[model samples]
Target chain A: MSDILLEIKNLTVSVRNGKSDIPIVKGVNIEIQRGEIVGLVGESGCGKSMTARSVMGILPGPARKSGEILWHEPDGTVTDLTGLSEKALRDMCGLRIGMVFQEPMTSLNPMMRIGDQVAEVLRIHKLVRNREEAREKVIRLLKEVGIEEPALRYRSYPHELSGGMRQRVMIAMAMIGEPGLLIADEPTTALDVTIEAQILRLIRQMCVSRHMSALVITHNMGVVSALCDRVYVMYMGRIMERASTGQLFANPLHPYTRGLLSSLPRIGKNPEYLTTIPGNIPEAGREPVGCEFCLRCSDDERRCFFERPSEIETDEGHYVSCFMCQRV
Target chain B: MSEEILISARNITKSYSLGRKKRHIAVNDVSLELYKGETLALVGESGCGKSTLARLLMRLIKADSGRICFEGTDISALSGRALKPYRKRMQMIFQDPASSLDPRLRIRDIIAEPLRVWRVCPDKTEMERRILDLLDMVELKESMIDWYPRELSGGQKQRVGIARAIALDPELIICDESVSALDVSVQAQILNLLKRLKKELGLSCLFISHDLSVVNFIADRVCVMRGGVICETADTETLYAHPGHEYTRYLLSSIPAIGDDPVS
Candidate 1:
């Protein structure tokens, strides 16, 4: 029996702008060991969110998707999510795998009470038999996410809460189903620095307590380093590198990964203008024939412009999709 | 230190009544200034009345019990057409670029709105030339003037927003978290532009942001706020080197940096 709770193989995604399928998540593979945190990190339009939504079967449609998203059950049942019916998908969606979206202000219903919004998830997932029991569970969920005066907060609307508090409410709602896997998509990007750190700490601690696996989608290196156990660096919808958190940060091997790490403003080290990846991300249709990151790679060669590098195992559990992995 | 005080606020107090007689004091006993060519950063967490202070300075909202002295006049009491001259000298760049700009307006018209409203140029032809110059100043090309807000990227939209704020070449440009919406790599460009503009134009800026690193880079002096109070104010170097307030210390310690031991 495999301990991997979720496995994604050759997952390719393309946004359907009318009839054209513009690929966002290029051929990718990821495995989330049960109760482990695997971070899919990259900048905007990098397809981190798309991969998470694919696993939850919730990517906004007119999206063309391919490859296997398999969720392993304790009873030896494996469910293939890509071809699941809409009703079946919804039934398994929040209950089996809940997601905390990027912006809580948009994700949360404005008119509903915070408590009722949370209870709606519980009732939808059939976690409680009656409204009273659901209410009790909702309060407990809110309390679990560190909402003080849960009873009072339950009656408050989403707008009444601060960004951090609203995110806490969102997290509570996500956990209503006691999901095996949780996907948090840039949960703190909209918040301030102090609130961001607080929210990250809360999510990390909560995931551990619930014994739930998480795949956090973020662009911020700081957030990922603080919370994630394993890290996957993505570019142009493709996974460029994957390693344990310590290994990835200490010695990043992929050219794209090195550029991103070097670009960041390190603490206590003053530098000139941030060392940026030279060019902007290519338009979806303009994705390169070989390496999507070749245009910006400082060590780019003629071969890199023509031949796509396949993911090679550099070390146990560490993978890089780059010819210069040995040197980078 | 500059010879002239470009702008100053004296004991600015603004309060709003919450339903009954109970009032919410948004800004209380606040006083600050902007010099001829210095960036005064207002650092605070949200709901600490930073936005209120910005609005108060701009006279978007009137201060209930204080004076905003611009140049030499107490313009807090001015309204409608009376305050037009003062409005021309101070421009505000808002928090959200997407919402701050009008969806219906094209890039040219949005930047030109202030010029047209103030009638800065003698004729429409001169206004077009001036608008193009402002676009170049913010690093946007001439062709972008025709594009709508929807056509631009986040960084592009923010540049357009900056162009609009500096449209009239205002003496004081109040940027309220202008780079917060941008990506980290993109943030450097915007910050650099602001710094460059300050030196080139001898512009005074009231740079407001929660990011201490950003403020460290641009601010000549910083006023750290917590819970609607000015916790501490000093020269940027002095404040960072020896932040007296406990909250200020806590804030500095919280900034995440790789490879350095985190402040415990």
Candidate 2:
């Protein structure tokens, strides 16, 4: 039996310029299964964050969003998040679909105590009856995320904690709601490697133990390989490739995916020079008419310059959007 | 690598007074050397004083007690005019390319600023020619010369930063997390550019980064720092294969890689 948690159909996010609307996320379709850790990988400005923000109903002002963000309820009810009002979406955000941002220092309120911030989510949802119950729950959640001396740390301000500790607090805030789906955007990009490992481990443990689905958005291939069950490679606001983690690492079909993988400096492998993708990502509103990556791709062909290639399934679960992947 | 030392630092210490009573030691008594044509990396987490140490070596900040020698000359105490000549020989590429560059200046002027200050070019035509040569060297298009910093992407802005850093043809370049702010593919491109520049110019580089994988790829030697002190120093192969210090081993093991088994 297939258990689908969320389905995004033809999602397009665009921001209005002076006269024309510039699309940031163009026709992205993704499905997350129950308890599956899925990764949305892309560089900056690729609209990965915008997609995640759209799910939480948190797109910035002046950005027009269109598409069906279907959220599957356990009781067989389907909710299209795009149609919901701000009030209704706010009601469902933390309680049903939680999110964790990259910069913990800025995401958290420096003025408030760490304990109160975590407790505020419960208070907003009316999950707890009293202040005492909220405090106890927040402390337990903090301990669960591997924070040492949770009780003592509860009263500390955001500035008192380290980067890793602040991230744990953020995770605690996200998980305290016990949402079915969690969206983490570059959760460990700001931390040290050792601290990053711990945070990744905590996120994985929380998801598995609770049977929760997670949309881990990051540009790091290593993070995708270490934490994701399935991955989507995004480029210029479009999903270029989608496959299982094992399959993606073993056989990447898209030129962009291959370039990303080969460009990374592996720990044990020391090459004289890394293989590089020439040229920079095109400026907004200037993307190529055909393939988004054609300008920087070494394998681009004649068709790649004039006609956009749709997604083609290369394997049972693998899909790639590239001209070379098409079976002649 | 040859034993000819390009720069050396000995017994360098820096501290900050915290609230009049408590003191924060940013860099303890540390000593290191950079060979004439080898890339040496200083790897550590945030607050490990890697940036402070780099600043000290560049003479951007004064060390409380240390001797900084450049080509067998103690240049630590040199100030004002005496430090001017050494400044032309040691340049730095900052981590944030956007803020490090002047937003108001055109790309050509940004690259030509150092050339003008150092008086490398005598006239306007020679300056324009030199700027074009620098743009070519950094793999940036000549069309970018007239555009402002806002028009270029992150990678292109970083290239401009590199062009400015190498305008005066410095012997030693201190890259403080230079590629950390870039995407992986662009980072690889910039790394390749740096490697090519080093080989072509025979430049000595002090690469400071918190990323161990990047260090392993670029550096001939590595120094691992923790809590303002050096914990380990070794050649890249020996450091990665057989880390002498416990902290270095932990850092190596903590790196998330493609082949690593899923934590769950």
Q: Candidate 1 DockQ category?
A: acceptable
Show where candidate 1 strays beyond 4 Å: A74-77, A110-113, A129-136, A151-160, A253-255, A258-272, A313-316, A326-328, B1-4, B80-82, B102-106, B123-129, B253-264
The lDDT values for all models are 0.85, 0.93
Cα RMSD for predicted model 1: 3.0
For model 2, how does the per-residue alpha-carbon lDDT over B42-121 read when each residue is reduced to its tens digit?
99999999999999999999999989999999999999999899999999999998899999999999998888887889
- The per-model DockQ list reads 0.33, 0.63
Compute the lDDT for candidate 2.
Answer: 0.93
Model 1 per-residue lDDT tens digits across residues A164-203: 9999998888888989988999988888788888888888
Lowest lDDT block of 10, candidate 2 chain B: B255-264
Q: Which TM-score does chain B of candidate 2 obtain?
A: 0.97
